[model samples]
Target: MTAYTATVTVRLKRGVLDPEAETTKRALSRLGFELEGLRSTDRYEVDLDAESADAAAARAEEMAERLLANPTIHDYEVSVEER
Candidate 1:
């Protein structure tokens, strides 16, 4: 097995209400930062052993689907690299 690192990024689906991001955007605007929009995400890095990068990605994707992201409201992406 090869050591790999999987990075999962979870975010709210488009059209969902992200109050935290909206508050941040308002705060930034108050601070004179101009922006078209803002969004928030949660990133998780997992290190483990897998037979291949594909396997690592698959495992990470499963983890995201099962726990990291809420299927009803969140979307997630998984990326894998050698550790």
Candidate 2:
């Protein structure tokens, strides 16, 4: 089996209410962050044994679509890496 590295970024889907992000943005603005279009997110990097990058990416997508993200409100992106 070939060793593969998977990286995923998870975020609230568009049109979903992000209370945490809003609260954080308010706090940041209070602190003079002067930012716009604030967004909150999570990221993960997983190492696995797979035959190819395409396979790894497919598996990662399934994992995200099934477990890592909420289809109604969350979204994710996956990428496979060498080494």
Candidate 3:
């Protein structure tokens, strides 16, 4: 098996309510940062052994779907690289 690192990024869906992001955006605006919109995301990195990069990505995707993200309200992305 090859050592790999998988990165999973989780964020709310476009129409979903994100209070944390909204609060942060308000804070930024108060600080005089101009922006049309803002969103917040959670990133998780997993180190594991897999047969190939595809396998690593697949595992990470599964992790995101199963636990790291909420399917009903969240959208997630997975990426893998050699460690």
Best model per TM-score: 1
What is the Cα-based lDDT of residue 32 in candidate 1?
A: 100
Could you give candidate 1's per-residue lDDT for residues 1-83 as a string of tens digits?
99999999999998999999999999999999999999999999999899999999999999998899999999899999998
- Candidate 3's displacement at residue 54, Å, is 1.2
Ranking by lDDT: 1, 3, 2
Q: What's the CA error at residue 18 for candidate 3, in Å?
A: 0.9
Candidate 2 lDDT over 7-67, as tens digits, reads 9899998889999889999999999888886888988888988988999999989889888
Deviation in angstroms for 72 in model 2?
1.2
What C-alpha lDDT do the candidate models reach, one value each?
A: 0.96, 0.88, 0.93
Would you list the clashing residue pairs of candidate 2?
none
Tens digit per residue, CA lDDT, model 3, 26-69: 99999999988888899999999999999999999989988999
Give lDDT: candidate 3, residue 19: 88
Worst lDDT run of 10 residues, candidate 1, spans 74-83
- After the best TM-score superposition of candidate 3, give how far the Cα of residue 61 lies from its true spot, in angstroms: 1.3
Off-target runs (Cα >4 Å) in candidate 3 are none
Q: Spell out the clash pairs found in candidate 3.
A: none
lDDT of 1 at 25: 99
- C-alpha TM-scores of all predictions: 0.95, 0.90, 0.92
The root-mean-square deviation over C-alpha atoms between each candidate and the true structure, in angstroms, is: 0.8, 1.1, 1.0
